[model samples]
Target: MCRWLAYSGSPILLEELLYRPSPSLIDQSLHAQMGAEATNGDGFGVGWYGLDTTMRDMPDTRGPDVPVLFRGVEPAWNDQNLRELARSTSSGLFFAHLRASTGSPVQQTNCHPFRHDRWLWMHNGLIRDFALLKRDLALAVDPALYPSIEGSTDSEVMFHLALTFGLTDDPVAAVERMVGFVEATGRRHGVEHPVQMTVATSDGERLWSFRYSSEHQSRTLYVSAAISTLRNLYPDNPAFVGLSDETRVVVSEPVGSFAGAWQPFPESSYGIVQPGDDVIGDFRPREP
Candidate 1:
């Protein structure tokens, strides 16, 4: 339903990931190769970390320091401001999303990469029969955090649910619990399938990406082959020569047609990318 990319590594200009590739995220915004739709023009957003505002004469203002966000309710390819920002801003951990709203209104608030505190999240699929489950899920969120929700998208609800379930402390467990609750509630209402999602979240450092569905099939999700591997494959491609071993990416689709350069995440799986380790784990349906 949408297209997105999450990148982590040495600081680099946003355009390197959002615009430079043959079929970059911006290209996917207008001509997606694997998404359900060809265009994701509903809206777009980008989130990046900059040197802490309090830091002075920052050698590099980019990287994991302060989180900055740019969002607009306009086609990404047509946004002049996005183009300028992509060229000027840089970061080691960043997220870019192009939306094809699934029943949600086309507004800035409805864009993905919704943030709360130090975390940022984005989703590429929807919650089945959301209208039926919305109230139930809302009632379950911690009252103290409910007032922070600023939009009416299922994606936002999912984020808040994770926060309520201890996301800040144990993201994997919190998300599992949230999804378990969703599955249980949906089954009670006679919905055979109640979820379809490929979600990513970050707290300015490590990143967590998930792929799951109530049914067997889920949306497309991929993680880039390590930069070292890419360098070995394309020795002459100077673009990746300076990247570190920990540099990695998780994207909605392959940014280029480089065979074997992008690996499809296993169905019903989730991945965690830490400073030095990247791990993929199974996501089995929870028993109601």
Candidate 2:
């Protein structure tokens, strides 16, 4: 139970995505349009990557560009510091999440957009009967990575499971395996529909977004049509006029009423965004 947005493209100030849009992530925190709840004020977080200032000399490796993170137990819309930072910092890849804390406490650590090393993750759904499967899923994580666990949310545990299943190498397969394992474990413990999710993750370069549920129906998740296409469609809208082809956003819902500028991700599918101007890779379930 949360709402999130992931942006990867030409560098833009965080406010451009978190506050300026008509139905920005901050607006969703107070008045979500498609989320299960109207207010997702339990907690919030933002993670972003910028040029690795320390590696100015080395062009071979991506370098030690540490992500900047800001999280708090307060609602996103209510945080003055968030607004201040959003206006000041800029990044090519960033993630923002507002929580509707299911069973977890309304604390800073329980916020979405959990991070590990260079990876950042956020989820908008739950693992049904989590209490029953928590122990099993937690144990499934590599013991070495277990100590890093700091929160009590199912979303955080799911991140670790994906890592254990080799997310860094194969995010799609790792996530599928994670869902399979969670479903299997949940069924063994009597949960009818073991999972529901619309999740996003990034390693500061590429972004992966997935929409799935044990049942055929799942929560809302959408990716913006290419900015070039949107600009063409809404030629008179000044807000979209300056956006380049590389600008892309994936969110739980559209950020504004630019018709045809957003498309719903098909149920039971995932999308991968690579480093290019508006290039997208779409994936569906493999044949049984």
Model 1, 1-288: lDDT tens digits are 999999988889999989998988999999999899999999999987655344546565444454677899999999999999898787889999999998979988889889886789999998888989999999988999999988889999989998998889988888888888888888888878988999999998899999998886999999999888898899998987999999888999999768779999999998999876788999764532
**Each model's backbone clash number:** 0, 0
Clashes of 1: 0
- TM-score for each predicted model, relative to the true structure: 0.94, 0.91
Worst 10 residues of 2 by lDDT: 279-288
Candidate 2 vs. true structure, TM-score: 0.91
User: Once model 1 is optimally superposed onto the true structure by TM-score, how far is the C-alpha of residue 143 displaced, in angstroms?
Assistant: 0.8
- Give lDDT per model, in order: 0.88, 0.84
lDDT of 2 by residue, 157-269 (tens): 99998898888998888888888888888888989998899999988888999999988689999998987787778888777676667678999988876778788988888
Give residue 187's lDDT in candidate 2 (0 to 100).
83
